[model samples]
Target: MSLEIRIAAPEDAFAACTVLRRSITECCVADHKDDPAILGAWLGNKTPQTVASWFESPTNYSLVALKDGAVIGVSLLTGAGKLALCYLLPEARGLGAGKAMLAKVEETACNWGVKAVQLHSTATGEEFFASQGYVRSGHVRSPYGVDTIFFWKQLDRGAAPDTSQRKRFCNCNSA
Candidate 1:
């Protein structure tokens, strides 16, 4: 089935949290769970409230995907052009959803006049981000001893034709 992408609403907070937690547990910090406190801190000690607060922030934007009525994948990008969260349900992996979302993020960053974008990616996501043109900048260690790779991609400033072209490219899904 094809995936539908849209901005996440306030009501989608809890569902977003579930996907994030699952991503951390299954992909990012799976081995760190032996130390529960470390694990909690590693994932930012997140709860529904924390996730909701993130959604409410003006500095962040969420791109979410749904299959039927269930949320399947999501990517959160900060106003400063840092990618904050990206997770896909196990069933939703291996699809083009992640690539589409990454493209959406780049389009948004370009609109904001951001010179570049950065992210701390998990081991599993490293290859994907690299494939999307992000180059490793450094290595980051999570609170639970999880090592995250830092990557950054410079924006192709001259690529955006103008306001009209940008609007069209940014809203590619709407078209």
Candidate 2:
């Protein structure tokens, strides 16, 4: 099915929570190993109420990807250039949805007067982040024991540098 990307509203919290929980449970099992404690801790704050809180935050920029009027994915960015969340259901993987969501996040960052974005990714998501121009900056063990890869990507503003009215500070020695 074709997908649509848009700013997330408060009403979308429940659907966004569903997508986030499923993506974590099914798509992240390889990293979390189905450990209830780990998964529970990782997903503890992903309830619909928290999702609504994200929408309510003035410093947050949240987006949701929809298919056939249902939320299939969610992306969230903090005003401070942090990519807080990006999740999609199992069926949505490998279909460019994640990349699209990330692009929108970058756009939001630039609009918010930022030069780059950063995120802490799960081990399973490391390759995907790298493929999208994000570089590995660090790694750490989460409280749940899952390995996390930190990433940062430069945002392109699509404007060529203008050197028409420039200053000349270099002096050339006579040959």
Which candidate achieves the best lDDT against the true structure? Answer: 2
- Per-residue lDDT tens digits of candidate 2, residues 1-175? 8788999999999999999999999999888999999998999999999999998899999999988788899999998999989999888888777888898889879888787798889988889999988999999787767999989987864766569888766756423
lDDT of 2 at 131: 91
The per-model lDDT (C-alpha) reads: 0.80, 0.89
Instruction: Residues 48-153, candidate 1: write the lDDT tens digits.
Output: 7877778788899888878777887788899988998888877778878788888888889888988889998878898999999999989999656767899999
Clash tally, candidates in order = 0, 0
Output the lDDT of residue 17, model 1. Answer: 77
Per-residue lDDT of 62 in model 1 = 82
What's every prediction's RMSD, in angstroms? 10.3, 5.5
Candidate 2 accuracy as TM-score? 0.86
